[model samples]
Target chain A: MTAITVDRLHKTYLVPEREGGLRAAVGALVRRRRREVHAVTDVGFTIEPGEVVGFLGPNGAGKTTTLKMLSGLLHPTSGTATVLGHVPWERDRRYLGQMALIMGQRNQLQWDIPVLDSYKLNQAVFRIPDADFKARVEELSELLALEELLRKPVRNLSLGERMKCEIAGSLLHAPQVLFLDEPTIGLDVAMQRRIRSFVAEYNRRTGACVMLTSHYMADVEALCRRVIVIHHGRLLFDGALEELVHRFAGDKTINVELADEHPLDPAALGPLVDGHAVERSATGFSVRVPKAETPRVAARLLAGLPVSDLVIEEPPIESVIEQVFEATSAEVDGG
Target chain B: MTGERLDADWTSGPRQAPGEGGLAGLVRHDLRILRTYLSLGVLNLVQYRSDFVLSVVNAVITLATQVLGLSVVFGQTTDLAGWGPYDLLVLIGVHFLIGGVLGLVVRPSMEAMMEGIRLGTFDFTLVKPADSQLLASVQVVRPQALVDVLVGLGVVVFGMTRVQASLSVVDVVLSLLTLLCGLVVVYSFILALSTMAFWFVRLDNVLAIFQSLFGEAGRWPVTIFPGWLRIVLTFAVPVAFAVTVPSEALTGRLTYTSALSAAGLALLFFAASRWFWFFALRRYTGASA
Candidate 1:
C-alpha cells in the first residue's frame, strides 16, 4: 500500500528583493521588486506503507518546501500529491487527523503552559477518544521518558526534551503518516540516537509511513533503510543507503600501522597503483587506491616494507553523499 | 480469513500514549485553553487591582460627563432629534456595553491576530482543526473590559428607571436580542478586518482607524450624523448597528423595520466574514507555497 504519492509537484515563491540604504527602502514602499524562486520543481516520489524514508538534500535544496507541500501547510504551484488517498492542500479534516508534520525549528506547543496541557489541546484538535488519548499519552511519555518533563512549562524544558514532547504530542492521534523536517536537528548525539530509536520503535509497532529530512546523517542511518536524495529541486538518488555508498565511493582506504615512525615518499608508492592518495601519521599511514587495485597496492607495500598492521575501511557516508552531489552538479553544469 | 485478520489488525493498531498528564492535559486542549483564558483573565484583573479601580472611576466620570452633556444640550433645546437626556443616556450606556464586549474579546483577538501574522505565529493556529477565525477571536479574554460591561449595564438600568419608562419583559427580551445581534455585527466586522492581514500585511492602521471612528461616532445617535455619514457608519462599517440600533430597542424607539434590517445585516456580514476567512486562508497557504 502506498501511503504517499507526489507526482510532478512544483512550488515557486515570489520573494521581494530590496536594496540597502534609505532611498531604496523608501522606493520599495512605492514599487517593490520580486524574483521567482522555484523551490521545488517536478519532484515526484511514493512511499510505501510503513516505510521510513530519509529525505536528503543540501540547504535551500527544496527539502522543506516539498515536505511542507506534503503536510498541507503549502500548496503546490502545479501537479498533485495524495497522502493516504486524500489531497493534502485541501486540508480535509480526515486527512489532517491521519497525518502529522513536525518541524524542528517551529514549535506547536504553547510556551507558558505545561507540555501535558499542550498535548491535551492536540487531543481536542485531533478529536482523540478519552480512553485512546490517555493510553497514547502514557505510551509516549514512557517511551520518550517524559515522566517529569510533562508537568513543566514548555519554555522551561531543554531543546531535546521539548522535541520529544513535540513529537509525542503530534502522534497522539496515531497519525498514519508522519512528515518530520529536521526533527533531530541541533540535538546532542545521545538525544539524537534516543529520538532515532523512538521513531524506529514507533514505526515498527504502528507501521506508519515516516518521511524524515535531517542534516544529521545519523538520524537517517539509524532509522531509514531507504533514502531519497534531492539536490537543486531534483531527485538525485532513491535507493538503499548501501547502494548510495557503492555508487558514489570510488576507492577504499588501507591504513597500515608500523612498528615505528617511518619516512616514506608518496611519489615512490604512486607508480604501483592506478591512483594513489596517502596521508601519514606518526606511527601509521592511510592510503586510498581504486578498489580493484587494493590487492596490488597492498602486495607492493608489504613487499617493499615491513608492515605491522593494516585495516581496510569504506569512505565515510558524508563524503560519499558529497561526492554524489558534486558529480550531479557537474553533470548539470556540463549540460 | 488471513487477509481479513491482517486488515483488522492494521485498522485497530497500537495506540500511542497521550502527551501530558491530567492538569497538563487540560491546558493542552482547545476547550481547556479557552477556560484557562477566562480564568487567567480574572487572575490578571486581580493582579492589576489598581487598574480595575481606575477603570471604574473612569467609567463613573464618563457616565457623569454623558449626563451633563445631555442636560446641557436639552437645556438649550427641549430635545435633540426627539431623544431626551435619559433616552440618550440609555443609548450612551448601550454603546459602552457593546464597546466593552468588543474590547473584551473582538478587539483584543483582532489585534492578537495581526501580531500573530506579523510574527509568523499564525501558522500555529492554521494547523489546528478548530476554525482559525474562531480560535483567533477567542484566544484571549480581557478582564479590564468587564468593568466597562458592568458600568454600561448599571447605566442602562439607572437611566431606564429614572426616565419612568415601563419596562416590560418583552421589551427586555427585544433589547437583549438586539444587543446580541449588535455583538455579532461587531465580531464579524473585526473578523473581516483581521482577515485582510493575508493581503495587506501592513494593516496596523486599519484596525486603529475603526476604534478612533467608533470613539467619536459611537457616542452619538446615527441620526445626528449627515445622511451619507450615517449610512457609512450604519451599513459600511456597521458601528451604528453595534450601539445606536441596540440602544433604540431598549428605549422603545426601535422600529420593526430597522430591527429587521440590523438583524439581516448581522447575518449577512457573519456569512461574508466566514467566507472571507476561508478565502484568506487559501491565499495564505497558496502564497506561502
Candidate 2:
C-alpha cells in the first residue's frame, strides 16, 4: 500500500524584504514590502509501505519544507498530500498517532527531564498501551544501547546520545511512517554508522516506511536503497543510488603511485589519457577519466611510467549528486 | 473496543493521553501539575526564605496602607458608595486571591508561550493530540503565588467574621461558583490576548499591556470608577468579573441577574477563546509555509 502520496505540492511564503540600517528599519515599520518565496514548487513523490527512501537536496532546496508538509507540521499552499490515506495538514489525531517527524536540530524531549520521563510523556501523547509502550521502549533501549542513559536528564546526554534517545522517544508509538530530517547530522562517523544501522534495523523489524533527508551521503548510502534528488524545489531524479551515479557521473578516478617520487610535470601526462590530468601529490597522481576510457588510460600509463601501485574507484556519491544539480541548472539555462 | 479492555491497557486510565483524556483527564492532569507545582513552590520559598520574609513584611506594610486609606475615606462618613470598611477589606482579599491564581499560571504561561513561539518550542505543544489551549495554559505552574492565595483566604475569613454576616450554605456556594466563573473569564480573556501572538509575532507588548491593566484595575472596585471607566473595566476588559462580581457575591451585594450574566459571559468567552485558539493555530500552520 502507498503509505504516503504527494501530488504537485506547492508551498510559498511571503517573506518581508528588509534593507539595512536604522533608517530603513524605521521606514519598514510604516510601509513594508514582501517578496514571495516559493520554497517548494511543483514537488511530488510517493512512498510505499516499508520502503526506506532518502531525500537528497542542497541547502534551501525545500527538503525540510517537504518533510514538514508530510508530517502535518506545515500546510501547503496548493496541491494534495495524504499519509496513511489521511490529509496530513488536517492533523487528525488518528493520523498523527500513526506517524512521527524527527529533526536533528530540533528536540522534542524536555531538557531537564530524564529520558524515561520523556518516553512516558510520549506514551501519554501517543496513547500507547502500557504493555506496548514498555515493549517498544525496551526494544529501542536495547537497539540504541540507552540502558544507562535513560535515567539521565536529556540535557546531560551528548549530541549522539540525545539523538538516540530522541529517535527512541519518537518511535514509542510504533508509528507506521517516520519522517527523519537530517537525523544523523553533526555526529562522528562511528556515531553516524550506529544511528544508520539502528534506523535500518528499526525499519526491518517494524515494516515502517521511512523518508529521510540528509546532506550526508554516507547516511543515504547505508540506509536507503531508493534516492530522491531535489534541487531548487524541483525533483531532479528518483531512482536507486547506483542509477543516479551512472546517469549523472559516468567517470572513474584512477590513483597511481609511482615507484619513486618522479619529478614529472602532471600536465606532461595529461594528453596520454583522454584529457585526464593528475590531480596533485608528490609520489602519486589521481586522474579522472570516463568509465570506458579508464582501462585504456591505465594500460598506457602502466606501459609508459614506472608504476608501483594503482587504484581505480568510482567518484564519491556526493560529487555525483552535485553534478546532477549542476546539470539541472545548466538545462534550465539552456531552456 | 471495550472500555474495560482499553482501560486495562492504558495504565494511566481509559483516557487517550494526558491532554487527549477528555475533560476528566484534563482535570486530573491539571491537578497532578498543581501538586508538582505546589512542591516546587515550597522548595522555592525555602530557597529564597529571606526574600519571602521580606515580601511578607512588605505585604503587611502594603495592607496597613490600604487600611489607612480606608480609614481616611471613612473618616468623613461611615460608608463610601454604600460599602463600609469591612466590605472593602473583603474586596481586597478577593482581589488578591484572584490575582494570586492569575499569577500562578496565566501571566507566566503567557510569557512562556511567547518565548515558546519565538523559539519554535510551541510546535511541541501543537503536535500532541491534546487541547492546545489546555496544554499551553497548564504547561508551567508557578508555586510562589500560592502564598498570595493563602494570605487572601485568611484575610477573607477574618474580614467576614468582623463584618458579622452569617455565612449561609447558599452564600458560600455562590461565592465559590462566582470565583470559578471569574477565573474562567480571566482565562478566556488571557487566551484571546495570547492568541494574537500568532499574527503579531513581535508584539510581546500586548501581554505587558494586560499585566499593567490587570495590576492597576484589579485592585479597586469597578463601582468606584466613573461611568465610562466603569463600563470599560466591566464589559470591555472584564476585570470586574475577575474580582468585583465574585467579592460582591460573597458580601451579599450580588444580584441574581448580574451573577447569571457573569456566568453567561464566562461561557461565551470560553467558547470564543477555544474558537480563537483553533483559528490562530490554523493561521500559524498555514502561514508557516
Candidate 3:
C-alpha cells in the first residue's frame, strides 16, 4: 500500500527584495519590492508502506520545502498530496496522529525540562493510552539507547543526545509515516551511524515508511535503498541508490596495483587510457573511465603494464550526486 | 478532479478513531493536553528557583508603586469623579488582578507563540493533534505570577473591608462575574494582537503598546479621561471593561446595563479573536491561497 503519494507538488514563496543603504531601507517602507521564489516546482513521487526513501539535494534545493508539504506544515501552491489517505494540510487529527516530522536543527522539546517530561507532553498530545505510551517509550529507548539521556534536561544534553531525545519524543505516538529532515546533521560520524542504524531498526520493527533528508552520504547509503533527488525546485532523479549511480554517473573507477612497491607514474598510462582522470597514490593508481570502457581499459592495462591486481568500482555516491547537480546547473545556465 | 484522485486511492477509507472527531471530543482532548503543558511549565519553574523569588519581589515592587501613586493622588482630593480613596484602591487592585492573570498566562503565552512563529517552531504546534489555538494559549505556564494574583486578591479584600459599602450576595456574585468577563475580554484582545505576529513577525513593540497603554490608563476610571480617550479605553482596547467595570461592581456603582455590555463585548471579542486566529493560521500555512 502506498503510504505517501505526491502529484506535481509545487511551492512558490514571495520573498521581499532589499538593497543596501539608508535610502533603500526608507524606500522599502514606502513601496516594498518582492520577488517570487519557486521553492518546489512540479515535484512528484510515491512511497510504499515501510519504504525508507532518501530525499537528496543541495542546500536550498527544495528538499526541506517538499518535506514540509508532505508533513502538513506547508501547503503546495499546485498539485496534491496525501499521506496515509488524508490530505496533510487539512491537518485532520487522525492524520496528525499517524505522522511525525522531526527537524534536526529545530527542537520541539521543552528546553529547561527533562526529556521525560517532554515525552509525557507528546503522549498527551497524541492521546496515546498509558500502557501503549509506556511500552513505546521503552521500545524506543532500547532502540535509540535513550535510557540515561531521558532523565537529563534538554539544555544539559550534548547535541547528539538531544537529537536522540527529540526523535524519541516525536515518535511517542508510534507514527506510521516518519518525515525526518536531516535527523543526523551536525553530529559526529559515530553518532550519525548510531542514528542511521536506529532509524533502520525502527522502520523494520514497525513497518513504518520513512522519508529522510541528509547531506551525509553515509546516512543515505546506510538507511535508504531508494532516493529521490531534487535540484533547483525540480525533480532531477528518483530511483534505487544503485540506479541513481548507474543513470547519472556514467564512469567507473579502477584501481590498479603494480607488482613492485614503487608508485606508478600517472603519465606512463597516457593514450592507453586517454580522456580519463588518473591519480597516483602510495600503493597504486586509480583511473576513472566510462562505464562501457571499463572492461576494455582494464584488459589493455593488464596487457600494457606489470599489473599484479586490478579492481573496478562505481564512483562514490557523493561525487555522483555532485555531478548530477553540476550537470543540472550547466543545463540551467545554458537555457 | 483531485477528489476523484483521492477517492481512487482511499480503498480502506480514512480511519475514524472512535469517539474522537467532534467538537466536544476535541475540547476534552485539548484540556487533557493542557494539563501536560501546565505540568511541564511547573517543571520549568522548578528548574529556575531564583525566578520564583524574583517574581515575588517583582510583585511586591509593582504593588508598592501602585500604592504609593494612589496615596499621592488621595492626598490631593478626597474623591475623584465620585470615587473615594478606597473605591479607587479597589479599582487599582482589580487592575493588578487582571494584569496578574495576563502576565501569568495570557501575555507569556502570546509572546511564546510569537517567538515560535518567528523561529519556525510554530510548525510543531500546528502539526499537533490538538487545536492550534488552545495549544498556543496554554503552552506557557507562569507559576511565579501566582504571587501577583494573591497580592491583588489581598488588596481587593482589604479595600472592601475599609470601604463602608453594604455588600450583598448579588453584588459579590456580580463582581466575580464582571471580573470573569473582563478576563475573557483582555485575553481575546491579546490573542487578536498576537495573531498579528503571523504577518508582522516583529510585533513585540506593537504588543508593548497594548501593555503600556493598559498599565497607565487602566489605573483610573475611564470616566475621568477626556471624551475621545475614554471612548478608546472603553471600546478600542476594552481596558475600561477589564479594570473599571469590575471595580464598579464592588463599589456599588455597577449597573445592569454595564454588566450586560461587558458580557456581550466579551463574547463578541472572543469570537472575533478565534476567527482571526484560524484565519492567521490559514495564511501561515498557505492554505487559503
Candidate 4:
C-alpha cells in the first residue's frame, strides 16, 4: 500500500495587507485589506511504504506547506491526501499515532529536564506500554549512541547532541511514516552525515517511509534515491536523483590541457562552442557547454587546438539543483 | 546499514491510546498526561532547590501584605459593610488560593504557549496526538506556585477558627466545589486572553491587566461592591466567583442560587474559552509562515 498519496493538493493564503504610516493605519481600521497568497498550487505526488524521497525547493516553494498538509498539521484549500489508508487532515488519533513529523528547528523536548525525562512525557502522552517503552528506549539509545546524553538536561547538551536526543525522543513511538522538514539544516558536515546515516538506519530497521526536505545536497545524495523537486509551488521534476542532474543540469564542462607550453589565444578557440562560457587557465581553458554540444565540441576542440588532455564532466549535484530552481524561478517570474 | 527490524508495537498502549470508549476514559487519559507534564515540572524544579526557598519567601511576604491590606481596612470600623474581619479573611484566603492556582499552571502555560506560537514552536504542540487545548494549557508548570496553594489552605483553616459560624459537611463540600468552579472561571479567562496571541502575536502585556484586576478586585468581598457591578463580576468576569462565591459557601452564607450561578458561569467560561482556543488555533495553523 502507498504510505502517502497526494492528488492535486492546493493551498492559498489570504493575508492582511496595509501600507505603512499613521494615515494608512487609520485607513486600515476603517476598511482592512487582504491579499491572496497561493502557497501551493495543484501539487501532487505519492510514495510507497519504505521509500525515502527527497523534497526539494527554493524558499517559499511550498515544500513545507505540502509536508505540513501530509502530516495532518494543515488543511489544504483543495484536493485530497491519504497516509496509510487515512485522510491526513482528518487527524485521526490512530493516524497521528502512526506518523511522525520532526522539524529540526523546533524543539518538542522539555528544555530543563533530562532527555530521558522528556521521553517519559512522550511515553505518557503517546501512552506506550511500559515494556515497549523500555525496549524501544534501549534500542534507540543504542542506535543513536544516546546513553551519555540521556541523563543530561536538554539545555546542557550541545546542538548536535540535542538534535540526537530530539530525534530519539520523537521515535519512541516508532511511527510508520516520518516527515523530516529540514532535519539537518544547521549541523556541521560530519554531524549532518551522522544524522543522515542515523535516519537511514532507523528507516531500514523499521521499514518506515521517510519524506525529507533539506537544503544540503549531501543529505539528499546520501539518503534519497528518488527526489521530488518543486519551484514556485509547482512540480518541476520528480525522478531518480541522477535523472534530475541529467534533466535540468543541461551543461557539461570540458577541461582541456595544452600540448604546447605556450599560452593559447582566445580568438583562435572562437569557432567551437561559440555561445558557451570558455573560462581561461594557464595550461588550457575549461568551457561549459550544453550537454548536446559536448561530443561535437570535444571533437572540434581536439582537431582545432593543441590539447594534451581533455575531460568532460557533468556539473555537481548542488549546481544542478540550483540550476533547476534558477531556471524554474525565471520561468515563474516571466509568467 | 543495519537491517534488523525494530520490534515496534503501534497497536499497543502507550498507556492505552485514548479511543477505548466514552468521556471518562478520555478524561482519565488526559489527566494522566497532565500528571506526566506536572511531575516533569517538579523534577525540573529539583535542579534548582534555591527557587523553592525564594518562592516560600515571596509567598510569605505576599501573605503579610494582604493581611496588612485587610487590617488597614478593618482598623477603620468594627465590621466593614457587615463583614467581620475573620469573614473577610476567608475572602483573602480565596484570593491567594485562586492566585496560586493561576500561577501554577494557567498563567505559565499560557505564556509558554504564547511564546511558542510567536517562535513557531507551537507547531510541536499541534503535531501531538492529544487535544491541543490540553497540551497548551499544561505545557509549562511552575512547582513554586504550590507554596501559595499550601499557604492559601493554611489561611482558610486559620480563618475558619476565628469565625463565629459553624460549617456543615455540605457547606464544606459546596465550598470546595465552588472553589473549583472559581478556578475554572479564572483559568478560562486567562486562556481566552492568551489565545489572542495567535492574532496579535505580541500580547505579553495582555495578562498583566487581568492579573492586576483579579488581584486587586478579588480580595474585596463581592457583596461590598455596588449591585450592578457585583452582578457583572459574578457572571461576566467571574472574579467575584473566584474569591467571593466560594468563601460565601464556606462561611455558611452561600445561597443555592449563587452556588448554582457559580457552577453555571464556570461551565460558560470553560465552553467559551475552549471554543476560543480552537478558533485561534485554526487561525494559527492556517496563517503561520
lDDT digits (tens) for residues A114-180 of candidate 1: 7886776676566576777778778778777899999887889999999999998988877889989
The alpha-carbon RMSD values of the candidates against the true structure, listed in the order shown, are 6.0, 5.3, 5.4, 2.4
Clashes of each: 17, 0, 0, 3
DockQ of 1: 0.20
Arrange candidates by DockQ, descending.
4, 3, 2, 1
Residues B1-289 of candidate 3: C-alpha lDDT, one tens digit per residue: 0111111111222233412768877777877887888767765777768988998888889889888988898899988898898998898889889988888777888898888888888888888888889889987777777677888898899999988888899999999999999999989999999999988888888679888988898888987888998888878899876798999998889988889988998899999999999888877842121
lDDT of each: 0.79, 0.78, 0.84, 0.85
Best by lDDT: 4
Docking class of 2: acceptable
* Model 3 quality (TM-score): 0.94
- Residue lDDT tens for model 1, B1-289: 0111111122342232222335454245556446655555555465457877887888788777877878888889877787778888888888889888888877877887787777665766765554467668876566778888988898888788767567688878888988888888878988998889887776889888888887668878888888999889888988865788878888888889878888898899899999999888877742231
Going through the candidates in order, their DockQ values are 0.20, 0.23, 0.31, 0.50
- Candidate 3 lDDT at A257 equals 86
Sort every candidate by lDDT, greatest first: 4, 3, 1, 2
lDDT, residue A326, candidate 4: 82
Which parts of model 3 have CA positions greater than 4 angstroms off? Answer: A261-268, B1-21, B285-289
**Best candidate according to TM-score:** 4
Q: After superposition, how far is residue B221 of candidate 3 from its true place, in Å?
A: 1.9
Which window of ten consecutive residues has the lowest lDDT sum in model 2 chain B? B1-10
